[model samples]
Target: MLLLAECLNQQGKSTQAVPYLNQVRRRAGLANTTAASQAALTDVIAHERRVELAFENKRWLDLVRTGKAAEVMTAHGAKQKRKYSYILPQAYNITSNRLLFPIPQREITLNPQLTQNAGC
Candidate 1:
């Protein structure tokens, strides 16, 4: 199902991707996708991936791959109104450095040719 959705998305056929995405949605007891725009459809696919693949350890990588971790996480953090809110300001900064982890110091020391990643 996901393979079909991804193919259609890659082909710029978001409307066609709807059926495949909806199949997953329906199986999850959720309503079928009804997005009319490519961006909206892409969002639907990403959301389905999150719901359908929950706890398979893919969420963080998905967010980074889609370049949405900062925006989504920032918005989500803002919604929290309790003790957790205090950490939001310092957390979830979506910088270029944040996208990739810094090369480990040990690895860099072992290989002088290795360069440290930016924002480390």
Candidate 2:
């Protein structure tokens, strides 16, 4: 369904992209979305991506696009702090330059226009 949604979003048809997304989830034995607005839909889609595409490289771009890159990754790989797991890895420091992911070394050297982010 993401294929359809991606196409629709690219074509500025994201609102109409709902049906296709619903269809895809149904095929995966998932229920239909209950989101009531675009923001909710975006949140739902992000959670879906995290679950359905876990272990894949989906989070980085999603984080970057939402500008929650730091917020999300800071607690990444850590289960919620509830009555469950208590320890969490410190992935990124949200208040500092550590939030800025480093540019690839190859890209930096290949293109002088590129600059390295603070923490590399």
Candidate 3:
């Protein structure tokens, strides 16, 4: 169902993606699968993927692949800080430099041509 929704959305047939998206929503106990629903198709698909794929360790990779890592994580960090005053401000900083992980020291030492990623 997610595959069908993703294909439809990619083909610019977001309306067609609705029914497939709704299938997943219905399986998750949401009964409002009517075509009259007004949520954005992409958002619906993303939400479906997040919930359906939960705890499989794919969420971070998905956010990075979609180029939404920094934006989403930054907002999430702000929400966490706001909701829990004891949280440290720097705990969830999601800067551009964070988009890529630092090269491991062992690998860099083994190959002088290799350099660590920025902000490591």
lDDT of 3 by residue, 24-57 (tens): 7888899744444333666667777998999999
Note the clash tally of each candidate: 0, 0, 0
lDDT values, one for every candidate = 0.79, 0.67, 0.81
lDDT of 2 by residue, 1-116 (tens): 66556556456665886787787788889998876566666666667766777788877776776678766655653434432564444423455465567798899899999888
Candidate 1 structure lDDT: 0.79
Estimate the TM-score for candidate 2.
Answer: 0.61
For residues 27-105, what per-residue lDDT tens digits would candidate 1 score against the true structure?
A: 8898887788877777778878887898899888888877888887767666663457457466655666777888999
- lDDT score of residue 58 within candidate 1: 84
Q: What is the lDDT of residue 38 in candidate 1?
A: 77
Arranged by TM-score, best first: 1, 3, 2
lDDT winner among the candidates?
3
What are the per-model C-alpha RMSD values against the true structure? 3.2, 4.3, 3.7
lDDT at residue 29 of model 1 (Cα atoms): 94
